[model samples]
Target: MTVTVRDLRPEVPADVERFARSRHLAIPYVLWTPEAIVHRTTRTHPDAHYRSLVAEEDGETIGTAQVGIAHDSGEPGQGYLNIYVQPDRTRRGAGDLLVRAAEEHLTALGATKLFSWVLDEPGNRAFAERHGYRASRSAHFLRLDLANGALPPLQDLPPGVELRRAADFADDPRPMFELDAETTSDEPSDVGADLTDYEAWIEESWKHPLLDLDLTSVAVVDGRPVAFSAAYTDRATRYSTAMTGTARAHRGRGLAKLAKNDSLHRARAAGYKEAFTGNDADNEPMLAINRWFGYEICATEVRHVRELG
Candidate 1:
C-alpha cells in the first residue's frame, strides 16, 4: 500500500471529517470535530501558517498532523507540529511521511525550534527520539464520568460573589477576555503567551466551534468576572474544561474550584456523560482540584522539542 501525505482539503467535508476522525482515534482524550478542523484551517492567524496534513494509504486517510508557527508569540522561530496516527493503521509508514511533511513545511516557514506532543508510551517515546526530538515536561489527560460519577456538591455563593455563565457576557466580553489573558499568562508552559489581541481572540477563541458559552461558568464580584471555567462541548455527549483559573486577586479564595464545580454540575445536569481535561504535571494545585472532583488520569503525553540547524 502506497502511503502519501497531503494537505487537508478544508473545502471538502469528507477530508475534514477524515482528519478529525484520525485525531479522535489517535487521541480520544481531546475533542475533535469537522467544524473545529475547518475553523482551525480558515480562522487561525495568518502568521501561524497553520496547515493540517493527512496521510493516506491508497484511498484511506489514516493519520493527521497539525503544523503551525507561534504567530502570536513574542518569541519568533517557534513552531509546533503534533502528529497522530490511527491506532489500527500504524506501522504502515504513515507517521514518518506525515512527520517529514510537517517538518519540511515548518522549516520552510523559518522555524528554528519545533515542538510536538507524544503520548507517553514506550513506542511513542521511541518514535520521538528517533526523529531527533527530546522529551520535555509531561502532562496528564484526566477523565471524569459526569453521568455516573459523583461531583462535588455546589456550595452557597460567597456573600460578595455570584456565579454566572459565560453567555452572560454577550454584551461585552472584554472583561472575560482580560481574565482569560491573565489566567493564561500564569499557566505553566514551555512557551508562554500573551493574549493581547482582542480582535484576534474574538475570531480565534470566542468564535471557536467547540466553545460552549452556556456551559462555561464564571465567578463575578460586583459585576466584574474574577474567576472562570471555560467549557467546550462536541454537541454530543462529551464535555471538556478548556481552562479553569482565578484572577490574581481572587487566587486564595478557592474561587477557581468553585467555578469549575459549578460548571461540572451544570454539565452533568445537561446530559454530557463524559468529561475530559488536561493539566501540566507540575501544576499541583489544579491537579489536586481535579482529583477533588474525582477525575482520574487516563493518559499522559510528553512535550518533545527539536532544535533545527
Candidate 2:
C-alpha cells in the first residue's frame, strides 16, 4: 500500500472525476466538479503556479490538494494548499504525503507563509498542529434544503433599490466586478487578493464553470450594484453561495438579506435541491440572515496557518 502524490492529469477525465468525488465526499459544503477542477488549473495566473495533486494508493485516489500562491494578493509570501483526504481512508499516509509535496511546491515558489483549512475536529486539529500550523479564525458551513424547505418570500425592493440578476450585466460586468472587488477587499480572510485584472476576473470568476449568473441576485441602488449574493450551481440540483455582501454605503439597509433571499428563491425555483454557504464565525449579521432563510449549521472548517522559512 504505497501512497504517492502526483499532479492531477487534467487531460484525463477520470482523474478529475475521482478528485472531485473525493473532495465532495470529504467536504460537501462547497461545490466541486471535474470541469471546475480543470478550469482552475487551466485559467489560474502563472504567477500563482497552481496545481491540483491527488494522493493515490495503488490505483485509487484517496486525498486531494489544491496548492497555489496568492499571486494577486497585494501582500506577498501568501500561499494556500487545502488538503482533503477521503474520510474512509484517513489513517493512511495519503494526507502527510500530500502535505509534504504541497509544502515542497510552495517553498520552491518562494512562499513564506502558508494557509490551510481543516475540519474543526480534534483529529484534524491535531494533524494540523503536528505539522506546525497554528489555529486561526474559524468558519461555519451552512446548508439549506431547497427542494422542500420554505424560503423567505421575495419582497419588493425598498424605495430606491431594485433587484437584478447577474445576467443583466452581461454587456458590462465591470460594475459587478468592481463591487465584488470592493466587498472582497474588506472580507475577512487569511490571504488578501487583488481583483484589479478585468480579464483575469472574467476568466477565473465570471466565466467559472459553476457560476450561475441567472441565479445570482444583486441589489441595484440608483443604477449601481450595491449588494449581491453570488450563486454557483453544478447545473443540476446543488447550489452554493459564493458570496453575500454589501457595499459600505449600503450596509444598514438589509440589502444583503434581500439579495441573498432573492437569490435563494430563484435557485429553488430553478430546480436546485440543495444549497450551501459559509461565513466566518464572528459574522453575526450574515449568520442571522442565513438562519432566517432556514439554513442550518452543517459543518465547520477552521483556518490554519503556518510560517515557513
Best by TM-score: 1
**RMSD score of candidate 1 (Å):** 0.8
Q: How far off is residue 153 in model 2, in Å?
A: 1.8
Ten consecutive residues with minimal summed lDDT in candidate 2?
186-195
What is the C-alpha lDDT profile of model 2 across 66-148, one tens digit per residue? 99999989999889999999999998999999899999999998999999999999999999999999999999999999999
- Quote each prediction's TM-score: 0.98, 0.98
lDDT of each: 0.93, 0.92
Candidate 1 C-alpha lDDT tens digits along 129-169? 99999999999999999999999899888899999999999
Question: Candidate 2: which pairs clash?
Answer: none
Which pairs of residues collide in model 1?
Answer: none
In the order shown, the candidates' Cα RMSDs to the true structure are 0.8, 1.0
